[model samples]
Structures are given as structure tokens and as C-alpha cells.
Target: MKSLTSLQHLSDQAILSILEQADGTEFPDFANRMAANVFLEPSTRTRCSFEMAEMNLGMRSLSIDEAGSSLQKGETLYDTVKTLEAIGVSAVIIRSKEKAFYNELQDVHIPIINAGDGSGDHPTQSLLDLLTIKQEFGSFRSLQIVISGDIRHSRIASANASVLKRLGAEVWFSGPQEWMPDGITPISADEGCRQADVWMSLRTQLERHDAMEPVFPNYLEQFGLTPERAERFKPHTILMHPGPVNRGVELHTSLVEAPFSRIFKQMANGVKVRQAVLAEVLKTKEEKRYEKAV
Candidate 1:
């Protein structure tokens, strides 16, 4: 309770505890009582991940969107954050299109779990991803993870790369010149996959709307991931995506469902990582409560 901040130095044991919780096996409280967001950005995997996190831990869940909740009246982001905190949201899981979504939170001090902040960072996403990585290799060192495609517009690439690098993997990237992350090695698509222990395909987000470039398909043919391309990698290399994949665009759908795919496992780990985050935040609050009374 003396601390109110989330730490990047989260312990391995604590991380393990959450993973265990996700099994719905046995835990002290299930404290199963938490509040979080849904459908703000038309999500499937993230939306469900937070919801399942709540159910598995014993938290009643709620959904919010333009049509779902009343924020349609030009309410600002800070107001939204403050209101949620005021109503005792112990932890918040957000997914916003704006890259700086949590930047101007005029002191809305709840534990802001970044489900995503556009192409900026998705901290929880990073956590689950690393969890998946750890689950696959039983450790973080020396795993060659390739993050491919949509470099500029995909949060997963940045988050996954950050986490992978943090945990000691040699992470490489491959995508269009425009989408690449700054200050990282960019390998040719084939070479990247060839050397990787995990291949993560990020969806090309351009064609979602009507106004887009004509060179998209050409780009896909060159950069998109396919089974043949994926086969160039180590046979045990895992495949991943943050979903809403473009079938045959950034990646070939069949390859994504290949035997080595860990996309579903990564998605499933989101619930566990969130439960861990929520547990730490709420436990901090409870500790503070007792300290204040004393």
C-alpha cells in the first residue's frame, strides 16, 4: 500500500502467479472483483482478454464505446480517466487510436494499463507477448524473434520488440521502409524469417479505409509472410500476430495457423498478464488503506 506505481522490475514469481491464476485453478481471493474497458476500438482479442481476465479473477466487467457509453458528448480523455478513477476503477485497460492517448491525463492517478496507445506502446500486450515467448523457449535469451510488417502503424511490433529485447532475445525487424522502427536492425524479409525463433506478422493497416495507395498488393507480395517464407526459419520458430489479420495481406492465413503458431497462446496470455497487473495495483491500494488507518 506504500507504493502506487507499477514497476518494470516485476518479479518472475509474480508473473508466474498470474499465469497460474488464468488456469482458474486455485488462488486466495479470486478477488475476482475488478473493472475495465471493452470495444472502444472495435477489438476482438483485447476486448475478450480483459473480460476473461475479470471473470477468471472474479471482477464484474463493463463495456464502453461511442454507442455503448455516454462519452459521445465531446468529453475529453482526461475527464474520462478521472471519472473512472473517481468511481474506484483500481486499474484501467485502454485501447485508443491516438498514439498519445494517455499523455494528457491531468493527474488521473489510477494504474493506467496500456491495452494500447496506437502505434506507440501496449505495455500489457508486451507482457503477454513476452510471456508467450518465455513459455515457448523456457527462457528469454537468444531467441531470434522476427517482427514483420506495418512497422509504423502497429503497436505490437514496438511492444513485442521492446519486451523481447528486454528479456535478452535478439529481435530483428522486416517491413516496408516507411513502417520500420527507429534504431533497430532491419533484415530482409526472407533473412529475418530464416534466422528467427519466432515470426510475428503485423497486419498492414492501410487498406482498412477507402482512401489508400495502389502499391499495397505489390508491397504484400514482397514483404508479406508466407509458409514458404516461414519455413526458411528454424523449424521450432513460433508464429504470432495481434489479430484482426488481413488474411493474405501482411501474412498468409494458412501459415498463421501452422503448427508452430503461438498467436492464440499469446492472445490467451493477455488475460493472465492483465490479472497480474490488476492484482498488483489493487494490492497496492489495500496496503495504502491499512497504512493510512494506522
Candidate 2:
């Protein structure tokens, strides 16, 4: 069975195929199939999007969280997933605090969709982001995209940057100096806002930090998409944020629903992207099963 643990596992053709599938009106039926969402970490967007995708495809969804799962009783992630697989769940979508948590589940046969793994990679999020960008720009080549915010703690930053760059987009990182990673063109937030085709903001990720300072006092003025900074943006520049947005922090409250913002559009596209992913992955499993039966 195929699993989508990273974007590295997906070819350009495969990526385009999924996006194409998402835009189609008809979908395959998996009425009797079951999918499980096993989120060890807190989430709203990814989890809910997957659940909605599952329902849209006529699949039953089983939700498992830290509080309600065997994980609370010292069960390992592998054991928990194996249990679901043993029970014949069609696929398992997981979000974990541990980076590359899927490494531990290599032996499990079901299709594993990495919802988010610590700050490592979030393939599905990257796909939805691509869908959002593609819907707006209709292409990725030579597009100036600036990913600005808490880069160190952002899976969205890490996931999208590499893929965007490989797809021929000129990608840059702009945020707090402390959060900036090496090996990318780091620009000032002002420069990004002024020139970017897509200005994508990341959340502060306070829960991942050691300190409880939820909002840095000068984050908005310095690195965030404030109304004043946004005014400097090109007329065609589109704003993006991987939600749950911290109003007045990574983005000012006024810009959340501004004419140029694609924050909600990203969330809306997420369901279709995930629906494409689930359908494609599970279709392979069904094909193999048919082959074996024949």
C-alpha cells in the first residue's frame, strides 16, 4: 500500500494528479470503508478537514485523540496504529508531537497520511497550500513566495518552502532572525511584503516554545502582516496564513478577511486536497486487493 509521509515521496505528476482529482465533480465511492484520524497533538484544521473529506467520499471516520485512546495508558504509537490496522481500518491519518513518527510504523500495511509530525513535515498541508496558490496564480514557476513567521517551529514553513522551490518558485523566508533557518534567501519582512506574489504568514507556535510569551510585543510591526505593511504589497499579492491565526500577532486582525487574504481559501481547499489524497491512496489498496482476489 502507498503512504504519503512526505512530499519527497510524491512526484510532480502525482502531485498534479491529486490536484486535478480535487477539482473534479465526481468521486469514487468507498461507502463501506473506514478511516481513522489519530491525532496525538492538538489540531483543528487538519483533523476536521480530513474528517470532512472522509465523509464527502462516503467513508466512515473514527476519531482518536490522546485523551480517549490507548496512548494514554502507555501504548506506543506503533501499537495504537497496529490496533487500528488489526481492526481493518482502511487508512490512518496521524498528527504527532514527535518528528517522523511514521518511521515507527513502517511495518503497518495501511495507507498512512502524515497530518503533521512535530515540526518535521506536513505533506497534506503542503498540498492544500499548493492548491490555494495554484487556484490564484495558476502556476508556480518564477512566483515570488515569502513564508514569514515562526519558521523554526513551523511545519508549514518547512514543508512548503522546499516544494515551492523545487516547483520553480522563488521562495524566501522572512521572520524573526532567531527563527530563520539556514540555506534559504532570508529577506526582511518589508521586502517580502513589497515584492512577494504570495505573502504567507505562519503562527507564532507558542505551545512549542519553552516560554509562555504568547505574542511578542513587536512581532506585528517587525515580521507580521500589519495593515501598514500590507499597504506596501503589490496589487496582485495574495495573503495566506495556516490557521488558527493569532490576530494582531502573525497577522493583524484587519487583514484576516481583507480583499487580498486567502486564509479561508486555504482552509476551504484543504478538504478537496485531502479528499484527493485519501481517494488516490485507498484506490491503490483496492486495486491490489482486486489483483490478489483474481
Candidate 3:
């Protein structure tokens, strides 16, 4: 078993195992968690998911914000991390716009759970995505998922690509050249959708500041998944998004509330997935101690 430096820490078999273990516990006693919340970027879903996961595990937590920390006094990120670790932090659930923080963090004794990092990878999103897929399709094999919009700046897309591919599924990239990843394909947007077993639409994150002239007008005309296309793949496909959704932009508002949509359920899985991750980490730590005693 590998330590969870990234989402790839848990294999497909491990992921299912963790989920199974989590199922044996009730909602409020999922994994017996206790940790420090260290968020650099603002988040609602990641924050609440992690907190709820901790609560479900019957653990206490501390939430740190820039305004209350010496980080505002110009403390280096390394210093901040060291301070958190020194205070006996069991783990740090971090959200940063810089990837360097995540890379440097992998060497630490304390576990680091990335909420989001420099638009690179969001593993938890990948986990919930898998949970959603399993819940709806009842399996992961041979699923054709279309990833549309902001591919160049979408960490969720990258994580999804890796996790889905590892689980024996196909993924297509769709978006304009400016917003899309360079030299990668399923290049055509319309075609990607037409053949998709599932369509996952993403918001164009202007915060990445990766693209210019942010024109998002008439989004439904080109990028948004509509009622018509929904019916086209209705027999075989599903739609998913990670949002603060742009109502008429990347997806129709109605689709967000549709029976097939896993938006809310995904958020709920955030807690369970995280709870399972913490449990696994704790179990590993305990076994090491037992080995030393024996």
C-alpha cells in the first residue's frame, strides 16, 4: 500500500475497498478523523466535504485562514507547513494555487490531502467522480466520458483522465483551442459529445489567468449540453459538473436538477471518500506502531 501523496495513492481495488469499509460505519462515525484544515484558496465544496468527513468520524478540527495566521506577516509556505506539522497535525487538507506547495509537501511525515493545487490535480474530485460513476452506471469499464471546456486549466479534467483511464474507460477532450489543452484530442467538441457515454462539462476558470479575452457568450449554443443532446445520449449517457454552475453556460440549469445528475450526490460522497482516506491512513500508522512493539 502506498502513502497518499496524491490520488494515485489509492488504486481501483483500494478505492473500492475503502468505500466498502466506509459503508460499514454510520454517517456520523465514518472514519474516526482528526486533522487541521489548511486552505490557501477559498472553497465551499472541499471545505465542507472535509469538515463533514471529520465530523462523521467523530473528530475535532481546526480551520486556518490567512487573516488569522502569521502567513499574512509574510511567513513562507514552508514555514507555515512546518508549523502545522510541528503542532502535531495528523494531516493537512490544503488548497493552493501553486503546485510547488504540493510537490514539496510529499516528503513530510504528516499526510497531505490536496484540495486543489495549481490547476493540476484534484484527486478527491476524481474519487467522487468514480463513486458517482459506480452509483449510476454500476460499473467503470468501457464508459466513454466526454470532458468539455477549459481543459487547459481544468485540474478536475486531468484527474478524471488519469483515474478513468486507469479504470478501463475512455475520455475525450473538447473545447476551443485557446481554452483547450495543446495538441490533445477528441479535438472536436460536437463529435465528442455525440458519442459519449457520459458528458462532464466544466466552467472556464478565469482565476487561472491562463487565457485571455474571456468570451463566454452564447455558451449553450456551442458548449452547453442541451435537452436535445441529452436525449441523443439519454439511453446511454449521463451529465456531470463541478460547480458554482454557470446556469446557461456549460450546462442547462434543468440538467443540474435532473434525476441522472450526480451533482449533489458527488458533494455527499466528498465526506465519505475523505472519511475512508483518513481511516486508511490511520490504519497504516497504527500497524507501523504495532510492528515496532512486536
lDDT string, candidate 2, 135-189, tens digits: 8989899999999989988999988988898888988889877776765556898
Best by the TM-score measure: 2
The TM-scores, one per candidate, come to: 0.85, 0.96, 0.90
lDDT of each: 0.69, 0.89, 0.75
Model 3, residue 290: C-alpha shift (Å): 3.0
Model 1 lDDT tens row, 1-294? 211122244555554555555434443454545575734576887778788877766777556675655567888767776787788666667777777676676386666666766666776677777777777777878888888887766777766666567657887789766566466556788888778888888877663323553346576578888777876878688888878777878887787677888877887788777766666666776777789899
**Count of clashing residue pairs in every prediction:** 8, 0, 0
TM-score of the candidate numbered 1?
0.85
Error of 2 at 70 (Å): 1.4
Which 10 consecutive residues of model 3 have the lowest summed lDDT? 25-34
Candidate 3 global CA lDDT score: 0.75
Instruction: Give one digit per residue, the lDDT tens place, for model 3 in 55-171.
Output: 767777889877788889999767787888787666777888887466765557666777788788887777777887887877778988889888888889888888888888988
